[model samples]
Target: MSADEGTTPSPLKPARPSMTAAMRSSSFLNDHQQYRPPSKPDNHYGIDTVVEDLQASSINSPKQISPFNGIPSPENPPTIVESGLSHEYTHPNCTQPPGLTTDRLIATLFYKSTSPRVSNAVGPSSSPPHTASSPVRASSPTGADAEIPSNLAPSSSFDTFPLEPPTNDTEPLDHIYGSYVSPMCITSFLHLMSTFPLPRGSTNLTSAHRCLKLDAASDHHPQVVELTLAPAPSQDYLSLADLRKHELIYRFEREWNIDVVLRSDTLWRRHPRLVVFDMDSTLITQEVIDLLAATIKDPPDLAARVADITHRAMSGELEFDGAFRARVKLLTGLSADIFNQLRPVLDVTNGVRPLLRALKKLGVKTAVLSGGFLPLTSWLAGELGIDYAHANEVVIDEATGRLTGEVKGRIVGKERKQELLLEIAQKEGIDLEQVVAVGDGANDLLMMESAGLGVAWNAKPMVQMEASARLNGESLLDLLYLFGFTDEEVAILSKET
Candidate 1:
């Protein structure tokens, strides 16, 4: 080509020297020396070039980016700065990918970018380097809402493109509930998202209300981020079939201790009207029946026997009512005065008072359904200002003012708990789907199942697996986060007490 043809470009170089020859050389130029002529400047950029540049950087730099892309591949890896994001995660037991170089990883990230943004740039490496003035592509959906007319396209950053929110019909809204996802993990998450094409994110960071908008710096809890995930092209919705996306989700959870719950955009789910808690281990740390039996000093081993039965019932070993009734029989002659001693020392579970107070301030109805005696449950309801309280009534022999060794009313067993949940929801004029149940035992399973959301709080493994959600966190306040309240909102509500 002549100087007169300067406006046009020269023939491009071959894809590369063979992998064998390229692998033999350390620097990119060692094998592909002819591609960049010594006589000229060039701007030809491709995924392979991106790969080579990152590869060379990895080889020469002291720290490798690591296989999991700095999800802290080991117990405590250093913060990795790549592509303008600086975040580090320490997933102490997260499984790492097989050994892969940065080059291959970049290759994995862009292998799907077969569009003109990639193929059209394959001219001579002898052209001017990429610049702000160079014609660039915008990665947004092209349609009637296109900001730039097709005739006047301009260069834009990938960050300039906003990920579109999921429509009600196509992709449902969901949440990733974990304390681990930070701004830096955005890159890894984006990479995982890119593995399956996602709708673009927002360019309006200034005023944008992310699905979860938290001021992490000021928030005591890790900020909740609203995530909108969709099925990739040609893929069936995961609700109907197995989802490969969950693989990445579970991986992140395993490594970073995150729990991704796919919640709907419905109002009832995020802001339920009623929340029922089991009194024994859920609302309080101790089992009331076991405590009641412990006060029977005459039979030194009665508490031990009652506790064993209570444990078995909670673990689902024995029938709930049978075990409960047998335990009451052990409490046979204990004086009614025992209730006075247990009341003052009743230990509320950590985060219970604050959570109940917050819920009350928000006007969410709260209830305590217990298989234990009604007196303690009612006292708890009064103390916490809960709306409803239901429990078995201990039959006391009025003549002697001593225990009758039986319950007077209907047993508040698992089945009864379920019935009461629906009954209360109806009485409150709330929908059945607008109630939440929290418990820590097998008997609570049916009641939990009946509610829209069931949280197994520090429960047995079976309850954890079967419940709609589980809260193994240190406090119950995190539930408010799942409901989409921010730090300020939570603080304001939790202070009502």
Candidate 2:
């Protein structure tokens, strides 16, 4: 091909050394080579520059670029950037085959190019890269765009994303209830959230509303405030499930001795028709069965045995029915006179009177559903003006004035408790959703599930897991606050009474 004669370009050929091989050599030099002060900026450009230069020079003299081409083999492998994106080195001998455009060649050389704008997207080694020019992906079905910061996406190092308010207007609403021990000042609650944010949504930060205080004396027993938080951009709506999944919420609960309730506050205000309470630990401080067994002839030994059985039953380790029968047998021949003696020790839990009074004011029915005997439950219900009582009966021998060691009625285990809840709900002419059940033992779980809203009051682990809301702090009156009532409203109602 003489210079004077018009010569056609030789058909393009694949480079002698693969692009990957060239990239590896370049990376090796960059990593291991000592920097003797550079005379010019390295440009820090990677594989693409070499490829373009090679293609350009290949148009003139292809043979001269071969010596520089290094085939990447087992002895010399490609350097993989930890970010999962692979970069390749280029050689002038590496000329694209005929008909392949530069974009097509780059697309083939790299595994597969998604979009041209992706080149502007940064990999681990690339700095000051711009975001893809393309519009962001559409918002999710939840109307929240989970846009991960470009800096965070490549390396995969992140604990959480900072939540912003959702720009969209159609998201469902949610509220977070933060409750603590009495006299919980509004400022204290705010400080707690600022210190350890559980909900991390604008709704929680901006829409906080003080709910009714459970202990009417806010000056002394101010317990809680309800904050109606708005959804964050990443999360269109929050739920109890969302709160539980966050580690900060659990930490907030443990650290502050606070109980958090995330729910639709509106629905709970409808007022429960029947608020069924577990007689043992929930309504009263002691387990009636354990208390009864403590009065046995061998007080220490028999009480220990009965207490062990009671613990197992409440913890859900042993079946309540079998444990109940076994416990009653242990109390065989125990004097019935002990009931009178034990009556004084039957401490009605704190806030019972006020909670009961409030329920009565609202014309809401109340009941005591117990696995314990009627002797105590019936008496307590009557004491508190409870509308109904359902419990096992301990047969008393008139002649001896002692327990006959037998239960005369059906045993009220978990199933019976649930059945009684349904019975009470049906009798009240209300739907199941119009009932509230509070209990602390495993037996109370089914009844809790049966009710519209279940309150686990200082409950066992299992009950806590299953219940709708949990109260770790004291005061059954906390129920009113949970119902979205304010201290002023409760005070007015108390005055009306």
The per-candidate count of clashes, in order, stands at 15, 11
TM-score of each: 0.56, 0.56
lDDT of each: 0.62, 0.62
Which lDDT tens digits does candidate 1 get at residues 1-497? Answer: 76877676679877964568545766756566776634221344455556665444332334555465445435566787999998676331233346921110100010001111211121122221222322232343333333422111211222222334212121111112223345544445545545543223422111112334343443433344544333231233243123323566545433333444444435576678999999998888899998887777877888888887887688666799989889888888778878877998899888888898899888899999999888889988999889899999888988888998997878999999999999999998998788999998889999998998887776764576567665665567767766767667778889954
Model 2 weakest 10-residue run by lDDT = 104-113
TM-score between candidate 1 and the true structure: 0.56
Q: What is the lDDT of residue 185 in candidate 2?
A: 35
| RMSD, candidate 2, Å | 30.0
lDDT of 1 at 51: 60
lDDT score, candidate 1, position 46 = 56
